[model samples]
Target: MPHSHYAPRQHASARADAPRQHQPARPDAPRQHTSARADAPRQHQPARPDAPRMSSTTSSIPFVSASMDLSQDPSSPYYVHPSDNPASALVSPVLNGENYNHWSIGMKRSLISKQKLALIDGSILMPPKTDPTYKAWERANNMVISWITRSVSPSIAQSIVWMDKTYEIWEELEERLSQGNLYRIAELHQCIFNFRQGELDISNYFTQLKILWDELDNFRPLPKCTCEAMPDTKKYFMEDRVIAFLRGLNDTYAGIRSQIMILEPLPSLRKVFSLVIQQERQTFGNETDMKVMAINGPWRGRGSSVNRGR
Candidate 1:
């Protein structure tokens, strides 16, 4: 064992001749290699040929500018051009300071549809003796009569005579009244009495007079009497007393001139006259037709010829 321990040592060259060892890699080289590998896929791929591309200049345009352009175009749905606005013409310099008031179509139509006045009848201008104004008018007329009596002038005497005769006729008509014909006579009596009395109350008198005037306004001229005069028969008087009274008022009272003048035009009076005359003629015509029918009945029809008395 001593011999073996001393002989165990190998040659120094052989001991130094171990297998050739590889050198350790540098740290910077591996880090550089790792970075190159990571970048390789990005460098090999080609850019997409069909993808959409946006220009910075075009994208920078304002959205409001595009909207405004569309609004100005006439063909666009959102168009609102300056020339198309109606209010633009009304805003001129000349009209700016003016205060213009305008009415709507409906308001104008409503204004024109209203009634402004009532139609007045001429017969209503005369009132009867029972009216308060008629009494006042009578009192005033009595004063006038007293004055006339005191003076006793020829003209005044004539007026008194006329008034007396008128009163007589009116009294007869009022007492034996049958138709609307007497209304005018009654009104005339009241008016004449009022004229004679200057101090008559005019308030109720005017109102009553208006009614009578309106009534007489419907009168017309007398028709030619067709019937043969029967001896001792009373004649039917057809004169319009209301017209006569109006004429008398005009002649007697200068203060009432305006009222009297209003009747001068008398278009409605003329119309009433024509209508009444036509109606009267028609009535007479109907009566004559009835008489003819009665006369012809016996000849035309097979019946006992009994004379149908009219």
Candidate 2:
């Protein structure tokens, strides 16, 4: 019964010659070889012209790769996305000579998102000339330099083209173009002082003022005040801003401004904004009513003069 016609070929004498007729693709089979090549199957082998032989006893183990590149890994510090290029400006606005502050802020934000800020910020120091990593470091440095060059205007790029390191170019730009935030702070103050609701509506005027105030805040953050009197320093500054907002409003809001001032603790900037918007709506409604009444007639005003005026 052992060699009966009904028996499967695997259970027959053919099992003895299975190594030649059918070589199973087992992962552990390499360990059994007395002499293994230096370039074994475990190493990276290019796609061969012949199809791989697979059998029922094939191993599921994956082959080991020879390459150790981390550029594909998102979490790796050395990782660079395939899409990122030097010609692509990560920021929307290009850096001209005058807009250093805005441009620098935009660039810092873009660099931080890419995880390549370390390359320029001195976190990744240059390795030795003899070191293998020095080449990689140099490549990344060039990439950052290219990005900066493309982002700035041609004149600025020409000045920084000869610079070796990323940090030097960045520092040089800051040194050359940045007139210190003090000048910007003063300019902001003057603009804010002069800004008023002349032709602009309440919402538009407030938006303009808010933008200036926000930019100024970025340039000059309030100092840390641990003293007893200055414990709530930001609160006082906020109140001052509220006053500034009111001072810039059109004269039509004099009544509204006076009412807001009489409050002991003073209303917040947000509260004042809402109140002024409401007053603007009411004033607009009154003006509209006056226009409609003037067009209709003086029927209610002088009894029968409505028909005479027509």
Candidate 3:
């Protein structure tokens, strides 16, 4: 008789080479119920009501960063509050504590370009509440404040942060920095006195010299005398400037200096500057010619030797 199928095989060794078999799942087992959380779609957080909204049209502008743009885009890193800050893209000169005069001049040019000079120059006073221009005045005031805050260093900005009016900030900066202190004037004077052309080309030398002159002038400007002695004073001042310029030149200018010194009444500083510049050009030309001749000299001798050998 055949053995029952459910019974363990008597010849287990004979079935060892066959694949192993496992029982299937029973119908009595409980089924799994999948949670909605595992399959639900993701949701985005709503934007804040107070946040700036970027206009779709803004995408058309080239090279505009969201932060630097004045458009309503709070997501931009450089976005400034419209009511509290000026547009960050405004042209401004970086103002360090030093060189206030030049800085102020450059800032003025920038303000003029923007037509906002009246804001800082005290030409436009505060408008009355009933005036139509009051809104404009307020807008200009905010813009000027923004410009000042962005232009100055943090330490300097702290000094003028409390200033409300454009003129007030301007005046405070001028009073604090523009007044030529005696010590500063002396330092600039010494700088001018010791300045020399050295190895610098005439243009660079003159540029450095002019910087000293400008700084010195800021400290102790030429007197604006209109009296009977003004003519003599002007002449003396002119001669002094001429002497200062001539003294700083290279030794190569010695002959030119002598020619200028003997000019009876001495020409104007402008005329003297022109003459010196022309002399510099001529000197440079001569130097270039000499260099060319020296370089050619060696080649010419080599060529002659080669021809003679041939």
Candidate 4:
């Protein structure tokens, strides 16, 4: 298994002390708007003569122009869409330490959808106060924190709420939950070896086996080097998986498995699965045929007796 190298997010204190390039304010910069009489009482202005009277439904309602593209806005990265409301986005499967891998994957996908993945992975750098992008960056970071807090169960959230950075929270949860990876892999391997499909439908049986296979693969990903030997490694690994899959199949598939094993060049896992599925369909088809024959047996017997009598 190729392990992921996750660098922890730098602490806030470290970032604060780092040197920054500052741009000097220009003498020709735009002047701030100010009231002529600062001490004067505020007064409401009359509406323009051409202005339409506000209806009850339209009063005080802000209308966004159709041409407005939030994505083009400088602060759009921090702007959460209505469809991506934080509370709604928090509907992801809760992490209870047991299903960390699945939960993490789901949570990550949700974050990615909202363009907040950088907050979790530290892909985006924090900008200085003078930077124009600072506000958007800060808003996005806070939104992610809120989302994280709302998504997790109270017990899990409480433990991580103390961490400020999204990456820190992410790293903390991973450290706490991903402790039994090796043990889990061993358990899955044993389970695979001892699996027996019994009376379960072939589709369901294969689905169960696939879940374990996928989990095992995630825990121990195949090597990435595309050397000539990589194919052999993949073949060896896939062969083991296929064997495990076939070994667990019902006795009815014995002939199919035997035929597959005797082939000169072994089939891929997908091809093997397809063959097994076909065999399962055929098995059911045979059962159906036997049922039909049985139903017609009495009729055929009666017809023969009549012919003999004639």
Cand. 2 Cα-lDDT? 0.75
| Candidate 4 collision pairs | none
Model 4: runs farther than 4 Å from truth?
A: 1-77, 89-91, 286-310
Per-residue lDDT of candidate 1, residues 1-310 (tens digit): 8776655555444555543221234566777898898778666543332222334445556544543543344543223334332222212121111111111122223222311001011112223866534443343233323322333334333544555222332233233333444555576556644642122222222345555454444443344455666321222221233344334332224434344346543333344334433443453555434444444455554343333221
Q: In candidate 3, what are the lDDT values of residues 94-162, reduced to their tens digit?
A: 667776877887788877766667778888778797865565567667777888778877788888888
Leading candidate by lDDT: 2
lDDT (0 to 1) per candidate = 0.36, 0.75, 0.68, 0.71
Error of 1 at 113 (Å): 26
Q: Judge candidate 4 against the unseen true structure and give its global Cα lDDT, from 0 to 1.
A: 0.71
Greater TM-score among 1 and 4 belongs to: 4
Clash number by candidate, in order: 25, 0, 1, 0
Structural similarity to truth (TM-score) of each candidate: 0.14, 0.65, 0.59, 0.65
Output the lDDT of residue 210, model 3.
82
Q: What is the C-alpha RMSD of each candidate to the true structure, in Å?
A: 35.2, 16.6, 23.2, 29.9
| Deviating ranges (above 4 Å) for candidate 1 | 1-197, 218-310
Candidate 3: where is the Cα deviation over 4 Å?
1-85, 88-93, 223-225, 286-310
Worst 10 residues of 1 by lDDT: 114-123
Model 1 CA lDDT for position 145: 31
Model 2 regions lying over 4 Å from their true place: 1-70, 225-227, 285-310
Candidate 2's displacement at residue 277, Å, is 2.0
**Candidate 2 C-alpha lDDT tens digits along 1-310:** 8666557766666777776554564544764563366457545364342335353224333221224444555865467677879788766578888788888888988888888788777787777988655666677788888999999998888999999788778888888998667888899999998888775667768888998998898888788778876746878999989999999887888999999999989888999999998987787855434433544556644332222110
Model 1 TM-score? 0.14
